[model samples]
Target: MSKIVKKTKHKKKGIKIFSSALVVLDSKSLVFFDHKTFFELKFPKNTVNDLEIVGLENLNEALHKFIKENKITSNNIIMVLNSNLFFEKILKDSGDIYKEISNFIELTPFEEVCSRTIQLDGETRILSTNKKLVTTIKDILEKEGLDIQLVIPYLALDKHSLNTENILEVNGKKDLDQLLKQLLPYNLLTENTVLNGKPAEKPKKEPKRQLFLQERENNPKSKRPLVLLSIFIALIFVLIGLVLFMNRKPPEEFTAPEIHQSMPLIAPIGSDQQEQTSGKTVENTTIKVVYDNNLDSAVLLTKGLSSLGFNSVILEKAGSESNTSKTYIDFSTNYPQSLRDKLIGETNKIFVDTVVQDSEVSDYDVVITL
Candidate 1:
């Protein structure tokens, strides 16, 4: 385990700096810290469903009542979300940390989640929470006119010193206080952190696989096998050419034939016939266009597909709150390769960041996301 550092600022002797209120929220209770003391508010039974606060009105009333009774005046809030609402995994530090994180998220079963990464000594700590849960809490806090400074997971606390089961007990208050003192300096969540229920945009860089290939190609020791293979292939081609040269026949067989032959005439297909054939082929293929914060682009693309004689429909757009910028074209496994190629080519012409993939369980033959 690493030691957490408590940051202290040097100020003039008479200046007073107010401390921000720290609030710990879990499935069972809500703990509020004010003036170096912790206040607990236990939720009623059945109020929480699946680690989410389902009774919004009751929760709001309870929170306001607790604040009034406790006289907690601080508007700056630092929230600590308990483990029940989020998932945590410590991953060994790979050279390509971003790619590793992406792979982990893709493998997870959750479709919509907010994730944050913290770098440790030799590992990366990933904290992912249900997006809906986080969004609900944020909305409640914002509605109360509170400024949420930072939001972190309960895993940030020292496991050895603090008991996870008794997170709000009196015996652990000292340990929890010390941990919060250390965590406050880090400012885990900043303005730039986007936790708006969308996957974070990854920084553009060469993938780890491509970088490894480039490194291998640059190394002289690794080039021997490639050089040998190339030489062997070249030798085979050279021998083949020589065999053809040796088997060459003399060019003394140019005598014209005396017998006359009748050739069958073929009629060229007209434009209308070509149109009907293309329309029939395209009409059999159905396309669904889905968009996230890009309805205009999706509509235009759908119209373009319709004009091209393909059956296209604009599916319900994804949540506008998402910040994903990439365009994706998903084709069903049974979809025709020719149609897939045509759709992919057209999509690429329209969107610069186009990703082509095959979805085995897609309902539509083709699904486009803009």
Candidate 2:
């Protein structure tokens, strides 16, 4: 039977929260489609953070992990302009013939644009072309072996800061805004959301924002009540302590215990191993895992072995069957994610212990994924 000790006390270190990342960037190779001032670019009531970048090639992997941890896949992102590499050239000659012309021009190689953003997919429309150099950027893409599917014609245009209502005279932007209205969805920006229309009255926030406001409304009162309660609790505790001290019966703890002593030999920790604190107990253990595929799985399994207080964990892939008529296991950790994902690709095969296999992969310890 365990008794709750009232007087006996132990000190503990307060827990520290591990900070989470909201944004992870590859580099400054970005272009901002910002219509608002930089001051308005951020949220007034939310927190924003970024991560360190290594290189462009590893950008996808970094973004994958970042999105996984934040539990968010899509959000408004700000991309920086790489001034050293990117250029903004407003072509005037290819206005009406943009789609036909840009298809040939983007293939023209600009060494500066080579390391910059690649065209994902886009439509071309002439922004009043006068006359300029035209070339397709296909050679650069071919040199990189990138299969281009999206031919998004990005205008190498100069940044203009002007609102439609403010401008009294039209400055050659007649059909562009109409075309822009059609293309707003592709930009992921709000439709009819530009400076042309009467400024929206900042639409009433959804219920989501109301929750925050409600929390704020309750916070001050809650804190005040909490403080008052704490003071009351402290007063009661002090009273009890004072009473106990005044009429104390005294503690009977003069002698040390005469329990038998024993010699213990602790095995030295392995070089690749570390001590594990599980829940509230210390344990000596050994773990074993077998994974037939994935270099990362092998690495993670080895790491889990030591992290779990295990003596050792061994992993071995299933080899070609020793006997005839053995079914082949198309095991992989590539794009498919799991066997089910690769199931349509690999049919007529019996799955042995599918849940058990997937559970170990699905129930991993990390907050993010590869």
Count of clashing residue pairs in every prediction: 0, 20
**Ten consecutive residues with minimal summed lDDT in candidate 1?**
208-217
lDDT of 1 by residue, 120-182 (tens): 444557666555556566677666666666566655554224432223222334554654555
Using lDDT as the measure, the top candidate is: 1
| Prediction 1 TM-score vs. true | 0.39
Candidate 2's TM-score: 0.18
The CA lDDT at 240 in model 2 is: 97
Instruction: Write candidate 2's Cα lDDT for 1-370 as tens digits.
Output: 0111012221323422121101111112221111221111221121111212223334443433433444432222211112222232332344342233233334333211121112222322222110111112222222333232221112221122322111112123453344343333222112111121222122233323221001223335547888999999999999999998999887788997697759776876532232122211113222233344444654554554345443343455545423332222222222123222323222222322232122234222211111
Report residue 92 deviation for candidate 1 (angstroms): 3.4
C-alpha lDDT of residue 87 in model 1? 65
lDDT of 2 at 89: 35
RMSD of each candidate? Answer: 37.8, 41.1
Those runs of model 2 whose alpha carbons end farther than 4 Å from true positions after fitting are 1-57, 68-87, 92-107, 110-370
